[model samples]
Target: MRAGRLRGTLGSADRPASALGFRRVLAVFGALVLLVGAIAAFALTDQVWLGVLLGAAFVAACVNVYWVSRRLQHERPNR
Candidate 1:
């Protein structure tokens, strides 16, 4: 059986939640911008590959942001 408790707090809890929330929001905004750019690239340019790449990147970023948010929410404070 594990006998010792975890020693430190989650780093996200150490800072104000608003800061983390702001960063999360910023990440979402950036992802949306990428999506818009992808759409524009698909419509306005001959490079269909560029649109595909940007769309993939946007999807990856959205997944990443969701992952971070879930991780932070599930963490418990060491008190």
Candidate 2:
């Protein structure tokens, strides 16, 4: 009976795909943000202040990627 209960619980705990899916989504979002930032920087190459804004956006996107990577790593269990 105890073995059956354990098996039932383990079966319900099978959510590896959900975690990976979230990470994949975050990665794609971050890439999109970085791409937008790069395009903005190129478009505003003549304006110093706009360049600063684009640089800030690029930095923010990099920080977001780092944060998401940490979250994904934390969610994954060591083998």
Best of the candidates, lDDT: 1
TM-score of each: 0.66, 0.53
Backbone clash tally (model 2): 0
What candidate 1 gets wrong by more than 4 Å, as runs, is 1-18, 75-79
Pairs of colliding residues, candidate 1: none
Task: Report clash pairs, candidate 2.
Answer: none
Weakest lDDT window of 10 consecutive positions for candidate 1: 9-18
Q: Tell me the lDDT of candidate 2.
A: 0.63
Highest TM-score scorer: 1
Quick one: RMSD of model 2? 5.2
> What lDDT tens digits, residue by residue, belong to model 1 across residues 1-79?
3456544444544432435556678778889999999999999999999999999999998997897677556653332
Candidate 2: stretches off by over 4 Å: 1-13, 19-44
